[model samples]
Target: TISYDCDTYGNPIEAYYAETFTPKVALYDGDTFIKYIDSNFVVWEDLRRIDYSYGLNLKTAGCNRKPDNNWDSLAKILNPLTYWTNVYSKDCYSGAYSLSSSESSLPFPIMNSSNVNGLSWRGSEDGHYFFTLLVIDPDFSYCTLKTQFSVSITGVPLLVSTQFLIVLSTTLAFILVLAATYFFHPSKRKIKPL
Candidate 1:
């Protein structure tokens, strides 16, 4: 996602995507977490973790979900497009998501520190799979934002269409030829010692 700084009037003051999420909130920031500051200037770190209150579970026993101190996990859902954040943290002025496979472990940065956004998954036969990401802090009160994406998977052998007969026939023919050649090769025997 891109970044841009805005003035008090909410105008674009600067724009760039470095290797981290800007602690200072901006006019149009593309991140998941939204930070808020109260009258006392105590950046109210009211970030939410995964919404596992429901009957949803994230990791298994051996593998536990990681948590971030800068940002907090707001919600967890089944989405294939993007990985979701399971934990969030705060650091005085700013905060971010904790994208970890286990407690306290963080994934490497592919784009920037803010790159860690959220956790998501797709319905798989083996059950389900998803990755966790970290989200940058934000202004949640006046600024409400959400990141969304989609994914599509195909080629389930059990769900093959009847029209796949053409391809199957070609594959079978090729395999038959290979088997015939291997078993009935002309080099069945070589010249014996004189």
Candidate 2:
């Protein structure tokens, strides 16, 4: 009988075993416990078992149009045995902007390896973007996980000179006054000099 505690670091746990032997596996959450066993009674010479936990946490820095070389710091893998394979990103609204190494297309240069080293956005517009990370376990081909995160890019504010503002305000005021006089004021009749 193997006993395992689920309160370790608050990560989800998964157990895998070879199909050679039928073993009773029990899951306990809080005070409730559930038990299940394989219906087939088969015995084999080789049997293997493994237990692991999996989770992901992601964070991004301030909204800016630049490359962040600290991509590894921004993402945290709860499982140490797993490593990321690919990182993908696309615009949140139009999906016109996309970046990935597999696609061999990127707006800006990014470190594309087993780990996310860096990321950059050279979009023409400022908006929200989504990133998807693919994690996989080398020992288990079937074990793969995908996590997503979002980032916002804020472009620099458009600048307007003080003189331009003053001129625009004056022009608008004059136009308003002319409109009021033509629409609201009563017309006056003038006599011609003979």
Scored by lDDT, the top model is: 2
Error of 2 at 4 (Å): 38
- Candidate 2 wrongly placed segments (more than 4 Å): 1-117, 136-142, 159-194
Model 1 per-residue lDDT tens digits across residues 129-150: 1122223334333332232211
After superposition, the stretches of candidate 1 with alpha carbons farther than 4 Å from their true spots are 1-88, 92-102, 106-136, 139-141, 152-194
| Cα lDDT tens digits for candidate 2, 1-194 | 23223242122222122111112323345568754322111111111111211111121211123232233333343222222322222212242334233322212212223222233333333434333333332332344433333334455233457558888999999999999999998868678899
**Reference-based lDDT, each prediction:** 0.30, 0.32
Cα RMSD (angstroms) for every candidate in the order listed: 15.0, 21.3
- Pick the TM-score winner: 2
Cα TM-score per model: 0.23, 0.25
Clash pairs of candidate 2? none
